[model samples]
Target: MAHLQPKTIVIVGGSLGGLFLGVALKQLRKNLNIRVLERNPTCLLHDQGAGIVAGQDVQEFFQRHDRTHTPLAVTSHQRLYLDRKGNVIDSEDKQQHMTSWDLLYHVLRANFDGVDSEYAKAPEPQDNEGTAVYGYGHQVGDVEIDGAKPLVIHTTTADGNTATFEADLLVGADGPSSTIRKLIDPSVQRTYAGYVAWRGTVPETAVSPAARDVFVEKFPFFHSNGVQILAYTIPGPHGAVAPGTRLLNWVWYVNYAEDSREHVDLMTDKEGTRHHVTLPPGGIQDAVWTHQKEAAQASLPPQFAELVAMTTVPFVQAVTDVISPAAVLGRDARVLLLGDALAGFRPHTAASTNQAALDAMALAEAVGRIVEGEDAAEVLGEWEARVLEYAREGQRRGVEMGQRSQFGVHPLRG
Candidate 1:
């Protein structure tokens, strides 16, 4: 009888990239054990409501990893740019689709059901012993990576239990303010863009008949000027709803002045209940909402103005910039950075999620090759090279677009 060699993998941050990687690797390794450490108590995971347009890279990856819940298409094969007055400036041939963050999360979660029979007939049982596991309410306290069998992850469980686990590999799938990254390399900077975003969704039922008619009739509507706004219908829990019942999502960017910093910080209310804070949230201050209302009345379109007024809970995020050290701490062979953790891109390109999906597939292939015993570090190094090249290119492009957007020169100048 042959004994099975054990392989343990720890992923910090149970968000998109982390979960996607865990599930993809589990499906591939079949023998490696996987665990995800997510800080937010399970209750706060679904509060975010922004929508993302998945590119070919993401679409193909989701199809391969977990096809069960790929969202039903919600975009109209068109990309329209508009002006501040809600007038069209130029249109493009970009065929894009929109899906809410939560919807995508649900689809990914469903794929991890570990019950293959549902998606396939006599589907080769996913390694019954091999599992892709999720641990909620576990906050990562600190991380220390030693040579082989490195990566000591200190965590606080949901039940308030403290424990430390070690793994061969550690990934910071954590978002903008990743604690792991901070411990690994403190010099990496997260710069602010002097802007803040107020994001929220209004159900089809909440929106007025007129607003619904306009949103459904058109896919994404944009408004330019220093105040930028983008709105679209995205997949929600009840399936794609009718115009009035569809999920209408919006992200509004407001430039920050020296005195107005508090306006952005005030996104959270007093009860430690974050209505919106880039990283911290409990409750929002009264004056912040007052300022937001005035700004909406003055800068936003009539439809958007109404939508903001309609939303019961709006999230505010103070925009910040984050870029990893040119020299990521890993051996540069098997461990690599992906998504926002690698090269943080502004929202202008709407390519963040797409980038992450691309990372998952790329990493999977690299790991597959590593399993074949062909120099794990070498394979990973090559992957990092490719990621860095493309990520830097994308970042450059995003910065250009952001600058153009600020000056009202972007194609959609709306």
Candidate 2:
């Protein structure tokens, strides 16, 4: 009898990239063992991320894979630009689609976990000892590369205890404040874009009929004095798609000097905790929300102000950017960074989720070559050359778009 060691992959971060990588890899290579580690205590997270455009990259993947309880997105057939009073300044009949963050996350997670979900397709069986494992309470603490092939990953689990495992490949998909990226190269710090994104969602049944008629099944944009606001409808919690159950999602971006008192004030939560990243929903202080409301009434159109009024808990995400010079880590390239950990683009491009989908899809293809006996180093070279180009260009575009929205030139002005 002969014994064999199955190829193993450990993915850090169980959000979009990590789960997508696990599922894509499993779909591509059946005999491989995959593990995804998420620092979050549980899988049922809310307001961490919100609405996302249903891009071609993600839609392409989902077409071949249906793990969601239902279709992942809602379609909009027009683009409407509104003025301060809610007047339709410009309108176009263009088709688009969008989804809520929770919907995508739940679908990907169910596919990775092979679990029975409310609207999830039952995942394919592992059949053998091979598995697509998810570690919710486990957070990656460190990774050590041995020689060239396998990486030793140390993790701190829920109770402050530690554990270690060996993996043939280590992928860091941990997101914007990526621990893996920092550990790999300290120079790639996030650059705050002198602004923050205020986001919120309103249920279809909660708003007035007139507002619902305008916002439902449409993408709307508004501009005022260097501020940009956009809104679209998406599925409500748990992928609810009935007309009255959908959600109206909106994001408004406003500029502020980085680390200045103004910026600090906005990033501070109700309890005065200065959050390093975003002020999640319900964390806003009364004074801050009041200030924002006053500003909206002064600058935004009446309709937008009304939208803000209907919002129960608007959140804030500091606009920031990070692009790593290298994707493959370690002297021998045993580790790789993907998605936001590699480069976080501004929301302007509406490509963040697609970028992650691209990363997972590309990584899966690279693994296919390795399965055909390609050299690991050679595979890394090919993968990096292709993906970094897309990531860098996408990040550049996002920054450019964000700048235009805030300061470059106002679309409404033109």
The number of the candidate with the highest lDDT is 2
Give all candidates' CA lDDT scores: 0.65, 0.82
- Model 1 TM-score, 2 decimals: 0.85
Candidate 1 minimal-lDDT segment of 10 residues: 115-124
What stretches of model 2 exceed 4 Å from their correct place?
1-6, 47-49, 124-129
User: Which candidate should be chosen as best, given TM-score against the real structure?
Assistant: 2
lDDT of 2 by residue, 219-243 (tens): 9888766789988899987788788
Model 2: what TM-score? Answer: 0.94
| Poorly placed runs, candidate 1 (over 4 Å) | 1-6, 70-72, 83-85, 113-125, 205-210, 217-224, 238-244, 258-265, 271-282, 326-328, 331-335, 407-414
